[model samples]
Structures are given as C-alpha cells and as structure tokens.
Target: MLKRVEKAQQKWGGSHTVIDNWLNERQELIVLYCKIAGFSPYEKKDQSLPEPSQIQAFCQILMDYLSAGHFEVYDDIAKACEKKGLESQQLANTIYPRISDTTDIALDFNDKYAEVDAEDLLVGFDNDLSVMGEALEARFALEDELIDNLYSNHAD
Candidate 1:
C-alpha cells in the first residue's frame, strides 16, 4: 500500500497531501492497537520495523494494518471523487472513520481482555484474527462489486 501511494505520488508529480493524510490516519490506529494490546513504546517508526514474534503483538498489528489499509485507500478514493464532484465520494462516510475504527479496536481489546489478567494478552489474539477475517471478507465483497461495475459496460 505504501508502494502504491508512492507510485501515485510519482505519477502525479505534486504534493501528495492526500496520501500523507491517509497514511497518518492509519498510523494513529496502529498506535492505538499497540497500546490496547500491551505493546510498549507504540511509536511509528521511520524505517520498517521487524515484526514482533509474539502472538498478540502479531495479531494486533495485523488487524490494525488491515483496518488502516481500508481507511487510507478509501480516503484517497473519496478525495479523488470529491475532486471530481462525484456522488460516490459520499460512500466513504458510510463506513466509520479511522478514529472510530481505532475506538472499535480498543473496545474489542478491552472486552476480550476484561476477565484475563494482563499476563495473558494472547487469549484475545484469536478474537482479533476473527474480526480481521470478517473485515477481509467484506473488503473482498466490495472489490468484487467494483470489478463487476468496471467490466459491466465494456465495449463488446
């Protein structure tokens, strides 16, 4: 996704403020997820960091990453549509913004960890996996619809 954003910037040749904004939105959600999952020093790194080998850290990262990707991509498209005066831009509002998604992630973390002591954060990792899996399902469905629309009126 970062590559795609960079490529878009290179192709367009201007300030990629929209891409930067989108990426920043995702970064915040990831930091929030790290906080809820008991990962320390949840700072966004300048360089790509090594993946945590721990289960809970891995799950939290995966979920937040997926959620962030969703937000950033849709936000970019939304901005594009808005620029073009297209009604489809309004669809972006149908889904929760990045902050809302962050809150949902924190709530999910708290709920799953409520009964368990802080020592067993891994117990809730499966829940995050399930949530992310469902999100992927929904994303694929939307992509399918988008593909259908794109091909539906093609020249014969």
Candidate 2:
C-alpha cells in the first residue's frame, strides 16, 4: 500500500493520488477485517462460513465507507471534467452513469447483505473498490494522453 501510495503520489502529483491511497487504505482495512474474522479470499466455494448477522454493524460501516469513497472520486472526476472544457460534457455524462451504478451497487450490497456477519459476505466489495481505482487511474492516464495529443496536433 505504501508503494502504491508513493507511486500514485508521483503519478498524479497530489490530491488524486491521496484519494487513491485513501481507497487503497479501505481495501487494506477490509482485508484486515477478513483476517480478524478468519476468512480467506481464497476459501473453498463449497465451504460455508457463519452468517453475517453477527457483525451487521461492521458490515454497515464498511459499506458506507466504500460507498463514500466511490462517490468522492466520482465528484472529483466531475469537477475535473467541468474544468477540462466544454468538450467534456459528453464524457461527464457517460461517467456520471457509471458513478451512479457504483453508488447503486454500494447501496444494494449494503441492503442485501444487511444481515451478513463478519464471515458471511462475498469479497466482491474489495474487488469493486479495486475496479474503481483502476477506472480512476485510467482517467489519470487520460490527462497524459490529452496532453500528448495536444502537443502532437500543435506540431502538425
């Protein structure tokens, strides 16, 4: 996580990298919680663990945390798009829906798994966070792409 944080810091300069690190921290926290509850992401599919009702409070907290993290990044992207130019309207619209989906997933998971205990829920929340991070990283990469494109066009 530290290495990723440093890489993000170097790559994105400041705030976005901090956001990336923040998301990464949540993932680490979830992993630690999983360890505390004695489950592995690699557990056998057929193996059954205890129900989630035993740790409903913790699950809710995690759900909220993840949901907020996602939305925060979404907000950041929206602000960036607004500043990028009038050309960003279409991109913002497309990305907004994706962010909406992310929020919906968070809410749905929180509701559906409301009864889940420490060991009962799926590991997909962690995966979803990772995917979100990657998506944001792609946006960061696009900053570089656009810059290069601008330079190339100017050279033409």
- Each model's lDDT comes to 0.44, 0.49
Pick by lDDT: which candidate is best?
Answer: 2
Mark the regions of model 1 whose C-alpha exceeds 4 Å error after superposition.
1-52, 63-72, 96-107, 110-128, 139-156
How high is each candidate's TM-score? 0.37, 0.48
Clashes of 1: 0
Q: Any residue pairs clashing in model 1, and if so which?
A: none
Worst 10 residues of 1 by lDDT: 147-156
Q: What is the total number of backbone clashes in candidate 2?
A: 3
Candidate 2 clashes between residue pairs 3 or more apart in a chain or in different chains: 52-116, 52-117, 53-117
lDDT of 2 by residue, 1-156 (tens): 334434544544443563555546555545534542445663446554434553355455556555555566546555655666555545557555554555565566456556754654566645544454454344434433332332333222
Each candidate's clash count:
0, 3
